[model samples]
Target: MTGDLGNLRYISPWYGGGMPPDPSLPNRRDARRNRDLFIEHAKATFAEHGVDASLERIAREAGLAIGTLYRHFPTRVDLLLAVFEPKLRDFLATAEAALKMADPWEGFLVFLEALCGAQAYDRGFNDFIARRFPRDERTEVMHDRVCQLARSILSRAQAAGVVRPDIAEADLIALLWANSRIAEATRQVAPGVWRRHMHLVIDGFRAGDRHELPEPSLSPEQLYRVMARLGE
Candidate 1:
């Protein structure tokens, strides 16, 4: 896992790569204020409505025109990247630390706990992690890196004789989807309930004398297509 961790460096493009200068900067002070207002409202709106939240609604909440919103963020993905960049950094940091843990199974558990905790706390992040946006090159790169990390971790656990060899990366993706749903449903009535369920699922995945599953795991291409469809 330590050797594999070195190959998994994922500096987010939003932070490292040069993005275009803020278009609102050249305009009057009011334009800069409007841009700030839009981002503030957008954070709340996306928190409530997920990533597909309406740009027009965000503008309205900001008391700015839709055209102004467009001037600040030409595309939904642009706004999304801005809104999620901080959260993404935090998540990636946690994941990276988990990958460096000495015990493969312990590392896997830490990763899942952090991932699921993020999903449970933020509806927008839950949606963000579950789907694939192929047209957005930066987002696609991030998603692919995340998937690769999951595969590496899973394989490490399997090789360590902790996790079941039959489990695949697709299975972990499926578990993420399941965890998202469970978190959403129980968030209001029982906010911490998902942890119990997750632990039970983890117990099931542990290597032991267990019943053989009849179905095959999804192929890598098949998993990619399925996640893309979910985005659509």
Candidate 2:
């Protein structure tokens, strides 16, 4: 229970969800039975697979037409998002809650860990729109919300004398992106790099802005594309 939402093992209703599925969605009266069938089977199938899981299998299990699946989910990621349902809302909620913690260090820990987990799940955090999907309105909204939460947490942490007073929210977001990338690259050969770097980062932030130097945050997508082209 690291508070990770991606792990379906902890999704309660999903765990108890029966073989047919939950009959809560709005299909026409004529399609109710089959829609419920699809929902139930899709839930189990996606749980077994992931965002890119087999739609054909889901349709087969749901006993619905493949067209029905596409009608319900215009894209795979949308279906993925629906799996977690409140994944974004949960993220925003977590950030907001971190702001109210009593200790600056602990509050910062909560914030850092949340961003870290987001990165761990995908190579991008605050970056859902960069994929094949159209611009995610939720990304912009979540960005602003999380940015405010980060600012509030940092301001409080600085006031408590645990963080550097001059560091801004943009700085934190950039650090999050950088750190997440680091974790992804190193998790295989350099395990625990994420936590180790977090300690190093917080140490720098706590050093009264006197650290020798630090990585300047850049656009991860741009960096990724540039690196991808080097091989071609």
Candidate 3:
């Protein structure tokens, strides 16, 4: 990964490097070129505007015609949905890549950090997405993907005798969601307190099912609602 872009995850020579040429991007690269360009800018636009960002703004930023944007996305929701797919793919890819860490616990911690980062940043967007399209198939698929990946990691740690045998996938996801809450609450009080709580939680998780636990983590929907109220 480092060899490709030297730890700059967002730099894609194919998608994000720089514009190809004027109007000639096609007859050159693969399909979805314009769509990829739209996704790149849309993410930035959405970050600033939440779900209210205009398709016109996205197309202007991407230097594409509005018709071209609609040709690919068809609807604003389609564009949002498309941009979200690869964003999450990047998220899960990072977690899976962390499995290469020499220490199981360290890898697990990094995975938790990845989750925390997403919650800190994308949780709002995620909630907006949920409200926009409750039970979206893509979101459901992502939920299952995350759940399965966490379960696999838990199994790995348990097999290594470092994690509790009874630790379910739900437990880790809850922990990540909880840590995000702390991060949101104490962001002004101190930076990285959520990271601190994450380490503490990890210690408890490693201690396994024998230990008393904090409150169960909020469901994804509940977390979204809580964060929305926090924003309000």
Candidate 4:
């Protein structure tokens, strides 16, 4: 009902905004079973090794042939999309809720906390959020949606004179990149250290008595190039 990927569906009865599964795929029960197995194993492997995890090993662990994996995913992005779909939907919902909060400053904090918390555990998701997949329309659209929501939350706070007016979406993205590295370095040694850093960063975002930043925010094209480089 929604292009070749069926209708857009709820992630569950409680949460919504999940992506549709491909309708072009086989409907046979065995085919569905294999797809489920591949997804389950892939989620774990990606969590451990990021999106570039060995496909061969994932296939072997799923108890399916490599060909079966190729048949379903076709590319690493496809697998990444499948693996992260639910989490992505959850994040979008959180952002939407943040946008609706009465206190713009509180909403800004809520949104940033959700964004950073997502990267604290899964390495694959950490990489996923930081990089840009320019060649894939699906991922591109997903990124666009994220930026849209972020900008809305940011502008709302700026309008309320809570967050600094100079703050941009690119600055928020920079925070995520910083959090990713901090998370990797300190996750084992100090699991909650990233939050401490995030609070400091959040303090810097407050409007009053803030000194001007020395440089302007990154241009959209520059930001795109940076994210593209991360993927490479």
Cα miss at 50, model 2 (Å)? 11
Local accuracy by lDDT, each model: 0.84, 0.62, 0.67, 0.89
Query: Which pairs, if any, clash in model 2?
Result: 21-40
In angstroms, give how far residue 181 of model 3 lies from its true place: 2.7
Measured on C-alpha atoms, candidate 1 has an lDDT of 0.84
* lDDT (tens digit, per residue) of candidate 1 on 105-155: 999999888878887767887778878889999889888878878888888
When summed lDDT is taken over every stretch of 10 residues in candidate 2, the lowest stretch is 124-133
Expressed as tens digits, the lDDT of each residue in 1-232 for candidate 2 is: 5445435534544554324444754546546666556666755664344344588888877777899878777765556555544555777687778887777789888887777666554532224412223255543454456656777888889888888766766567557657756876786797577788876776778835475546544454554343234212
| Candidate 2 wrong stretches, greater than 4 Å | 1-67, 75-77, 121-136, 189-191, 207-232
Worst 10 residues of 4 by lDDT: 6-15
TM-score of each: 0.85, 0.57, 0.56, 0.85
**Alpha carbon lDDT at 55, candidate 3:** 84
Instruction: Using lDDT, give the best candidate's number.
Output: 4
Deviation of model 4 at 25, angstroms: 14
lDDT tens per residue, model 4, 28-81:
777889989999999999887888889999999999999999999999899999
Residue 197 local lDDT, model 3:
80
Number of clashing residue pairs, candidate 4: 0
The full ranking of all candidates by lDDT, starting with the best, is 4, 1, 3, 2
User: Which is better, 2 or 4, measured by lDDT?
Assistant: 4
